[model samples]
Target: MNIKRIEDTLNEFNKIGYSRHGMNRLAFTKEEEKVKRVLIELCEKEGMEARIDHCGNVIMIKEGKNPNLAPVIIGSHLDTVYNGGQYDGSVGVGVGVEIICSINDRNIQPERRVELICFVGEEASRFGMGTIGSSAMAGKFDQEVMSRLTDQEGVSFPKAVENVELDFETIRLASREGERIHAFFEVHIEQGPVLENHQKKIGVVTAIAAPTRLKVTIVGKASHSGTTPMNYRKDALLGASEIALTVEEAAKLEAVNGTVATVGQCSVFPGAMNVVPGRAEMKIDIRGTNVESKQVVVLKLLECFKDLKNRRHLDIQYEYLVDKAPVKLDTKMINSLSTTCEELGVPHLQMVSGAGHDAMNMASICPTGLLFIPCKEGLSHHKNEFASIEDIAIGAQVLEHEILKSM
Candidate 1:
């Protein structure tokens, strides 16, 4: 395989505004359209059969010697977080395409077909719906969640589908026919410093951490800062700060495999500096490899809110934004990757994914495995995200070996 060509393709994608230091291809937007177009063109150039689904997912299939067998699938999302790193999703899809090219170049025909997929809207930034395309393909989503979501512009989910000329009914039924998948594999950046920190080239992911997103709103009476006595004030901002700190402390106490809690978003009502804030709303994201550890963290958060309700005599409301159980990768597939890496002289280690990916959703439908390469400085989803060219090439080689083994 020509690693330079793969790196060149990635660089070209970066030039397409796929990376502004990092990637900015949020789902269901014009940037997404550009990404889809580029991928379709690449597949066509390679003489692979390519098509888009009702949910705007891009699929490229390379025919094999035996057409009767189910295809071995390799993929990742094309959509990215705002200013996310280039390699996060792009590298996975790029490596899959490269594997196909390698197969064709060597005239190595497999018994099963191979597929490359670029799923749409895996990021929840736009429609507050993460894994929309994959979840629909897994038969896990329904009309209720679809109808309730609206973009920043107030475009409903159904309307967004319509805008893309997709029929909602067709997308809802996309999962029924995809069960023929023999197995699914994804190659992604580690999105952390683990591999680099350990001086490893590959990460054979054992499992993906489950993530729970909660929106907590603290309601307290707004009063004049100057006029309200310290003892008499029912300050929502103060209560929220306490809860936020409590969440951090709880994670530290329950640190099972590095369980973490983050308050990513916080809003205060009434922005005036002189006025006491009446309400504060914050989004809490928590993750852990084990459910029990996650539950402990969540229960501690609830307890913090309950305590604040009593101490401040304030009203509190909680809303669940997202709750997904952790997914363990197929052990067989992981073993295949590990063995291949060892045989090929690739540096590798077993690890769990800290960030969420489309691979998690794919696991619900078929046996899946995720491979990871390191990110420089443990940075991702930011402008400074980076991985070395050598690392990228090594990751692609590992993925190539894994795909060949799976076939």
Candidate 2:
């Protein structure tokens, strides 16, 4: 692998939306467009046919010797959450570009074509939904979902698509037939401390945990903080806080099942310090690989919400923002990855990903594999999120081997 070229490519991308806080390449933003343009230019130089599909995914194809065989698809998203780390999504794309570079340098023409896809809107930061590109490719995205989704700034999903110069009217064209893809693979940072703690260089993902996101609203009467007695006052923020703890406790009970829950976002009404909060909104994300175990936690949470509503005398209502079941990757591909790691003498662990990825959606269409490289302290989605170039190169080597092997 060309380590210098890989590092340079990643560094160039890191500059697009960079700030002291973190990367700001949120979906449908100008920074994301700039980065996509850079990728397209690079792919064009390598003699690959590149285009942005109606769903806004950048598909770059390097034709091989045989047109009969389906293409081997690899790559990840280019978008990031608000103040997210640079390496989270971009590393996979950089490594993919390097893979193409190596293939060209060796002048080896595989039987199957290679497609590197930089999917758009993989982060849910903007629309409260993610995997937009891959979902469309898997035939899961539609006009209804697009029209319903709105960003925090009140930008509808269709408007976001238009802002990026993509037409929503022809989005159906983005739906790819499953038989057209032979296999799919993605490399990403572990986003957790698992690999680093285990002293493993790579993680061959067995399955990806699906996220069930909820938007909760707690309503209570607002009153003067100083005048209202503690017994008489109704505070929505306090109720929300209790529910958050309940979420934590519920998740803890299911920790053995690898289930976890988080209340990542919370907003309280009434900005004045002198007045009690009249309402609070929270965004809850629960995930697990085991379906039944995850449902247990969800049921427990709903029960807790009811208890809180009755005891606190507050009106609590919640809407399901996202509720997707976990996805298991292809077993044949899993063994292939393990064998490749063994041949390469790379230390790898077979594990399940707690975080959601585009691979989860692709699994429905074709055999998909996800590889995880370690990040410092398992930190991701932050300014300091980092995965070494050497580690990424190692991942690229493995990815290249898999692509060639599949061919």
Candidate 3:
């Protein structure tokens, strides 16, 4: 494979939808459609067969000597976070495609078929769902859960499926087919400064952290801010703020090996400067590779909320959005990746992924592995997200070597 050509390909991909800050290819939107089309075009250009699956997954096939063998799947989602950097999902898909192109260029044929997938709806910005496509493919989508989900526009989950030209009932049964999948591999950015801070080139992920998302609402009586004395007020916003702070403090106390908690979104009902908030709703995300520690943190948070409710006379309610267990990568696959990195002379480390990826869903069905390259300043899901061209090329080369070995 030509390193310069691969770098050029990445550059070309980054050029699409070049906003002043970053890219805007959110899931299930027109921009996402354009991105998938571009991927299909690239696959076709490389002489690979490409098609969109029932749930809008882009599957590009490279036939091997024996078509009967289950294909080795490699890919990541093409959808980005709102105003996210280009390399987050695009790099994984781009590198997977380049692997096919390089195989064709070298006239290499393997004994097992290779399929590159660009999964849809990996980000939860749309329809309040994450890994919808992959979860369906893995046979994990529950109709009861999906039917209750809604998008930003207040569109129901079934209506969203209709808009995408997919039958809801069929999608509910989408998981039975992926059982034949061989091994799945995904390459992605670290989305943190670990590699960059350590001056390393690659991160071979050992596990993907589980996320515990809680939606907490505190209710109090609304009163005039000016007229209500501080002693007489039971401010919901104040109670919510205390819980948020306690959550942050808990995460800080548990901050060994990438444990983190984030209050990503918060809202005050009747958001007026002159009125005390009657209700405050906030989304709290707690993540950790250690399940026990995560549970401890969550328990502490709930206890704090309970204490605040009893003391402040506020109504507190909690809704869980996510509580998935951490996924450990297949040891065999991790060993293969380690051997590949050593052969390629790339300095690498076995680390746990702090952020969620599509690999988490795939791990439930088959042996899975993930490759991580450094992101500038450990920053991802932002406009200023960046990964060096050199790092990108090296990551692709490592992936190419690993694919060859795996095949």
The candidate that wins on TM-score is 1
> All predictions: root-mean-square deviation over Cα?
2.1, 2.3, 2.3
What lDDT, from 0 to 1, does candidate 2 have?
A: 0.90
How do the residues 1-407 of candidate 1 rate in per-residue lDDT, one tens digit apiece? 67787887676566665533567777877777787788888777878898787677888988877888878888887777777777778888878877777877888877788889988888888886787878777777688768888988898888887877788767876673456788888888888888988999999999999888899999998999999999998999999999889889988987756688899889999867988989999999998788888888889888888898899987899988778788888888889889999999998999999888888888888888889988888887787777777777787788777777777
TM-score of 3: 0.92
Candidate 1 similarity to native, TM-score: 0.93
lDDT of the candidates, in the order given:
0.83, 0.90, 0.84
What lDDT does candidate 3 reach at residue 209? 92
lDDT of 1: 0.83
Candidate 1 lDDT score at position 109: 79
Query: Cα deviation of 239 in candidate 2 (Å)?
Result: 3.6
The lDDT ranking, best first, is 2, 3, 1
Q: After superposing candidate 1 on the true structure, give the runs of residues whose Cα lies further than 4 Å from its correct spot.
A: 18-23, 176-178
For 70-104, candidate 3 gives per-residue lDDT tens digits of 77999898787777887888878878877888888
Those runs of model 3 whose alpha carbons end farther than 4 Å from true positions after fitting are 11-18, 176-178, 226-229
